[model samples]
Target chain A: MLKIFSTQLAGIFQNIEKSSEEAVEDAARLLAQSLVSDGTVYFHGTDEMMAVAYEGVTGPNAIPSSHFYDEKTALTAMDTVIVSARFAACEKSAAIAGAAREAGTRTIFIGAAEKGTDLDSLPYDVVLDTKAVRGLIPQDDGTRTALPSAICGLYVYQALHITVSEYLEEI
Target chain B: MLKIFSTQLAGIFQNIEKSSEEAVEDAARLLAQSLVSDGTVYFHGTDEMMAVAYEGVTGPNAIPSSHFYDEKTALTAMDTVIVSARFAACEKSAAIAGAAREAGTRTIFIGAAEKGTDLDSLPYDVVLDTKAVRGLIPQDDGTRTALPSAICGLYVYQALHITVSEYLEEI
Candidate 1:
């Protein structure tokens, strides 16, 4: 079962890499600008997606000048914010992205937005789709098993973190 | 670069699937016993590894009886606790596992324990190694990049969750 799951997960990862590479680079550039200007990079991950926020703000290779976004966070035009959630239409994540846009901050949204979803109208400056909207395995009752939304979110977070690190190194 | 990361991460996932399948099953069975007996299953994830804890406790498919482990959590022999960290030698995770063992509660450890590390002596009912101690990509300066410890931890958590769900369905 794990072997099958691994194969399916690899496909999910490949899909994200193929589709979201450019978006990741673009988000990195936006975040790099914040780092260059001494502006903080904030991460706001909704619910279980907070795993990505914790990685960006406090992981071993955490982005320099990063913070976990909170209600009291004061954003500025120079700052950048990354909002993550299981789905692109997450109201909580969209709220943060909207608020950041109002403050003139560059915003990035990382989540899976199915076709025809409201993601098309989100206020984020960049959207990196994780493409992990379903489970990997099927069950007897027709339901799915192994919904790894947080894992997918973290994979995208790793890519963004690496791209931002490369940008900072080039500077 | 993201493609390379995706490939390397797939390898990491495969490694965990190949080597830790039995351990995951054993841990799931242990956890299932607690669920069947009306004992709460606790997840204690250290630092960034808390992503796994959150997923197990409150994600879309949360365990039947699960909670986030805290210092104030009281354990009984009937209950089960799973401790996770980036490294097998994490002092904090070891502390929780130690306390759980002292209380006679079944314990499981999930993390990477490099060869010759003290992982051999960990007092836990089961240990599932994630094998994600190092970063995936190499840089021009000889240092590695894109360490996805939390991601790997979440993968293992997903596998365990699926196995436990299977057991519950069978019962």
Candidate 2:
């Protein structure tokens, strides 16, 4: 109960990004730059995507600094976008990201580029390649869950924060 | 970024009515309960309160199974609730929560409370009070941006999730 006052910083630091740490870091840098440039970042995800929007899982100091979804909160012309991607099969996000573009915000999609897929043409300025964990996917009460993918996506989000901070010209 | 997800978890873990750790265990339990009940937890937050609507700082694993904001989503009658409080001054939320209460969903508020404040007396079932970290006197940000009260509240929001999960008796 005390964490309502204390534990957030510790909890955020607890789960480290294993394999995809670098990609996440680079993504963070890009995001930070956009933020520093006065561009509010928008995070879009579908199905399990909305999950990322509720909290800023990868902000400096373990804070949920920026993750806009509300139309009222939408960034104006100068905003940048950062989105989480699992597989191309996550087509539900098309409308979501597309709508963001329509709102006059830029777009960036982060996910794995499954070999034959043509990822180079997307509107994203940076593509952070995060690979899936080879073996340990999460399953709760006999129900298989997409925890690994979701988990890694979050890490990339944080890494992007770092990268953004690193690239920030002033500080 | 990644912290948003962890922040969700951190908020849960931090806001438990029980001991900090026990609260996390309980919140995690509640998350499992939410899923098993076929209920999609509803998230409503605005401004700085977006932490409730999205992710937190990176590292920890705090991904929710599902959430709500869209009116068209499958949310209905007596599901669950998550709210953020800013000085307890809400107008729109009053109407929304009123309608939601009529629907029978349980509501939870993350805010500051005086020692005698009776959260149980309210329509909501739970209230995670961060004691609203107050400065001896209100100060301007130019003086310093350390509103420990708000930060504490954020941490509480981060903790409650863990407690709910722990309560549900699942992973």
Candidate 3:
């Protein structure tokens, strides 16, 4: 079962790499610029996607967005904020992205892009679609298990980290 | 870079599935028993690894171990606690495992098993080694990037979730 899941995940990663490589690189470059300029880089997510925020904040030059209400006071125009949600239309995620945009900071949303939703209309400067595949594995018992969004979100974050590190080196 | 990381992760996942399959199955059975007996299952971790706790608790029949200091009041002998760390020998992780042991509950420790560490000495009923590879990728700047433990830890949790779900089906 794990081998099957791993194979599926490997394919998912390949798809993301092929389609979202430029977006990941561009986001990383922007984040690297913010870090180099002494501007804050904030990470925000709710529920399982919070794993991405935790991973981001623990790394260099990133802060955890614990208090989104205080973003107006804390975030500056030069800063960057990255928000992840299992579903791109998550209310809190949208609110955080809106707040970041209001604060004149760059906002990036990373999550599954849903059709006919406000996800595409959100005030994000950049959006990296996780392309999370749901119900990939069907059990014999007539139930299906969905892939956890945190895994895909973390995969993207890891790629962004590597790209950011590389950009930092060049700058 | 993301493709490279994903390929490495796929191999790591395969290695863990091959080596720790029985351990994962056993741990899942134990967890299932605890849940069936109306015992609480708690998850705890610090830093980025806290994501594991978050993931675990959000699932069925699990609680987040937010306050480890009050384990005596909150946990009983019938309960089970799972703790995750980047290194199995983390001091806080060991302390929590000890406290859970003192509380007379079943304890599990999941993480990378470092050489020369007292991971075997921890008071855990079960130890699921993530087998996270260190220095998996070498960068152009002559520095090696270690595989993120959170990714491996989450992978283990996902497997455990699937196993536990299957076990729940049988009972």
Q: Pick the candidate with the highest TM-score.
A: 1
**Which lDDT tens digits does candidate 2 get at residues A36-132?**
6676777665433333443343322233346555546656656766666655434544555566667666666655445666665454555655453
> For model 3, what TM-score is found for chain B?
0.88
The global C-alpha lDDT for each of the candidates, from Candidate 1 onward, is: 0.86, 0.48, 0.75
lDDT of 3 by residue, A1-171 (tens): 776777777777788889988888789877876787788887877777777887787632133222232344578887888888877888888888787787788888888886766655888877788777474457788866746577788888887878887787787
Q: Each prediction's TM-score against the native? A: 0.96, 0.49, 0.91
Lowest summed lDDT window (length 10), candidate 1 chain A: A111-120
User: Candidate 3: interface RMSD in Å?
Assistant: 2.9
lDDT of 1 at A69: 91
Order of models, best lDDT first: 1, 3, 2
Between candidates 2 and 3, the one scoring higher on TM-score is 3
Candidate 2, DockQ to 2 decimals?
0.16
Error of 3 at B138 (Å): 0.5
Best by DockQ, which number?
1
What digit string (tens of lDDT, one per residue) describes model 1 on residues B1-171? 777878788888878877887898899999999999999999988878888788888787678788989999989988999898888888888889899989989999888877778665887789888888888888888988777788888888888988898898899
Residue-wise C-alpha lDDT for candidate 3, range B86-110, written one tens digit per residue: 7787889888878888878888888
